[model samples]
Target chain A: MIEVKNLSKTFTSHVKEPGLKGSIKSLFSRELVTKDALKPVNLNIEQGEIVGLIGANGAGKTTLIKILAGIVHPTAGEAKILGYTPWERANEYRRQMALIMGQKNQVWWDLPALDSFILLKEIYQIPDAQYKYNIEFLAEILMVKDQLKTQVRKLSLGERMKIELMAALLHNPKVIFLDEPTIGLDISAQKAVRGFLRQYQKEFKPMTILTSHYMEDIKELCPRIVIIKSGEFVYDGSLSDVQKMMGDEKVLSVTTQNGVFKVSVPRQDLAKKTHELFEEHYVLDLNIQDPSIEDVIESIMKNGIGAT
Target chain B: MKWWKDVMGMELRKILAYRSDFWITFLGQTFIQLMVARALWQAIFETQGVSEMQGFTLEMMGLYYLIAPIGMKILNGPNFGFLAQEIYDGTFTRYLLYPLSVFQYKTLTYLTYSLFYSLQMIILLGIYRLFISEVAFTSVDVGHLFLGLLLFIIGAIAYCMMGMMIEMIALWADNIWSLAVMLRFFTSFFGGALIPITFLPVWAQNILVWTPFPYLLSLPIRTIMGLSTFQEVTQGALILMLWTLIFMEGVKLVWKKGQFKYTGVGI
Candidate 1:
């Protein structure tokens, strides 16, 4: 179990003006500004639960993950993961947790991924049988067994990400933090990664927190999600609860000779809107459906929970 | 211990990956330094119309030039910007998550490169002794040679610690390349890699002896050449050890403070 109370982080940066003249002037007198990356927030996650964190850019999703992963220190409050404080970074705590960042690689670029795996095995002190089993299993499931011997830098991005996932999961961690794990992959690669993660989570049941821009990943894997905006959590509940918050609104999408068009209407007006769309144009197809999770969440992001 | 061995093996593989680049840079730098020193010293000797200056004969000066570059290479080890560069690029976030000390891992990598450089120095010395037999320093005392090798290893470790101390400043500064370049320039100039300390004035030499610079390269070379007594060698070891401890403490303190300041951005 992981528990956080009033966890917050603030960052201080220098405010510098542009040009060489400002650079020389600021050397003598500088201005510093503080930005709150994470406001005081409370959260609790149970074992075997995967929580999807949704936010726009600079919305503090990464900061929250970094704090829990022990990569960044918190400015206030406390957190305990499996009875250990993360920032203390005890070996016992670190050994049972894994952090995988898509934009950063833990494996050495110049050497083959297998060499890095062997080094990690030593670092984590994994038993021989367990290490061998994990190597074969993760490689086979991720479908990069052949690429393991190639230098990591030479492999394609998708292949490299699979190898990185293998490296992070070599020890079978109990808590996993994934930050944009499928950020830059193609559709097929993304599906493969999502399939691998879903299967792994089913077998291991590790408490997982995933942050991604892909709504498909969230919809497929996460039953529960927490929405953050401006360094604060605005909503935390099951996906269905968020959808229900739309409150009697339905979507009417019509495909005509021109193109497909979608509009949101109240439940009472769904029939009239569908009839009006069919009469207005040569409708190839028309349907009344629930608002998509993406549209609903996008609305919530642009306009706060009060608007919902 | 097994972890260290495995990581060191990885470090060795990285160093060997670009074999041609490594050799060209290492051998090319050594050759250029030796040629420049020889040209300058020959001109000075010819202009003075003497076989000796500052208690060093022309042959002895040539030997000094030959051994100084190799000795300095061993002490300086490989480049020292790994930490700073990683920090700047936010690649250092992995080290924070790993179940290992960043300092220990970096030290192992640094020592691995130093060991490779030591091997090169040994091969070069062997070739010098076999091909050029008329040099006065050829018949070196075995005991002094062993002591010098020990001092070289300690000095290399100390230099690694010092480099890390400078790199830890990356938490606050945007670019630490200039600091690293300045360190290299000072090490080479004051550590007697460019000119022998014996050529310097007495007061300057005395002042440098108290600093860690001379002990890093000049003292070890002097000890290996059988110019320093056993007592002086022991004193140099003690001073180097003390400096190493000081640098180690500084690194620890800076790392502790820097962790809070590290944002791990850009990833």
Candidate 2:
């Protein structure tokens, strides 16, 4: 449902020195500098698949999403979401897709969420019957039915987010792009959003791409993970494969007569290493397990995935 | 069509939600302006010892001040500060995500604000007419009145487009508040909303006539007051339409170029 080929975006900004002199100088001659926000990124997301986009700050995950959502045009290459060129911004493309930015708001701040919902209804040209059903279902799932009448500014962050999600989904979009949807929310609120997204994806089978700093959001909702660094994807595979990429590293715990000792070793060397240790010491209990996802991701983030 | 109507309805509700602010900005502020202009014009006519100044009788002066505020509303439309804020803060992403055009959305919003503003001015004028005894109502032909209203709508659109172009400059500049203030002062002084264009020096009036600023406020006011001949009104309307097209093209060009620089920063 989504395809991106060599999709890249470059941002150019003017550099000013300082003070009144610099300001005047800038007016006369602006020093232009270019930064690559995204570098020839490629990804293909199939229908009914939910992919987690993981990257450090300024790693181009959000840039990639914005490019696919048509908010920012690419400086080079192309991207198509559900068979429509996103940058062209065709009405059919917009109607069948939705982009939800957690830090940004789509609802009118002073008006009730229901009012914004009504506006979205017209915006997406949803049929009356379908709009009613979608709102009822989405509101009930997000547990914001009673809160829809209150002004958005008065609602809790979680409540507002629920309403935002409802607004994006009112048209029953075929593709969804979520950027930090769970950021700044309480744990329960985060859980609610993650749970809703999981169920929503299951029911609708829409291709979804989500970016969040929260590891739990990635672990719980995304079966396939795409990790990028420095404007390029370094790893793209299942959650378990990421551990394998961390290289056969397992945490080995041994409870001997001298208490317990924990050591890290490759999976291939575990048997020989453990046997040699058993011969040298009195081993009481031993356990071998792969490193946690967090440890692997941390190592990937600190050092490039290629290093792992 | 439904999308435009929806935006208009939502903007109306937003204005109603801040109805107190509406009263303060439109009624309280406009009342002060009218009183000040009335006092200034009264002193000028009294000092000159003449019943008329620049083809305006004392009653016509009173009528001009009465209508100037309404003309300002049409010429100013709603402030583009909201659009500027959106562009600066990166919330403009919301509009890009939606299927509707940002231009259409903002235009409809202005139209809604103008509708509410016109209603409020009519009510205020109704109240004023109850106490005033010698106010002149211009005897305009029906065809001319319709033509004037059409010209007024087109002129409002021109102002809106011009405002949008200025606000879109925020994508390049750090702050635009000063620019907006300067624009407001320029329009009020040279657009002939603060004083009659005929009262200005001949050279200044001649230059102002060549530009679109006067058509936005002064031409409509003069057309309604029957101060303009039918030929002048026709020519002014054509010039105003031409300016609207130019500003509309400018808006499109600025917005398209501005998007390339938009990193969706801040928000």
Off by over 4 Å in 2: A15-31, A251-289, B132-150
Native-referenced Cα lDDT, model 1: 0.87
- Tens digits of lDDT, candidate 2, A92-207: 89999998889888889999999998999999999999999998899889998899899899999999899899999999999999999998999999999999998899889888
lDDT string, candidate 1, A1-308, tens digits: 99999999999998889999889989998899999999998889999999999999999999999999998899998999999999999989999999998988889999999999999999999999999999999999999999999999999999999999999999999999999999999999999999999999999999999999999989989999999998999999999889998868988788888889888899999878778887889999888789888878987888988876
- What's the TM for model 1? 0.94
Question: Considering every candidate listed, which one attains the maximal TM-score?
Answer: 1
Alpha carbon lDDT of residue A236, candidate 2?
87
Which ten residues in a row are the worst by lDDT in model 2 chain B? B133-142
Query: Recovered native contacts in candidate 1, as a fraction?
Result: 0.71
Per-residue CA lDDT of model 2 for B1-267, tens digit only, reads: 888888988988888777788679767887787778888888988899998788888777776787777767766667647578787888888888888788888888887776666666556656665676235664534454455556667777888888888988998884697888788778877877788878889999889887888887788777766777878888888898888899899999998898776767754
Candidate 1 stretches with Cα past 4 Å from truth are A19-25, A253-262, A271-288, B132-136, B139-142
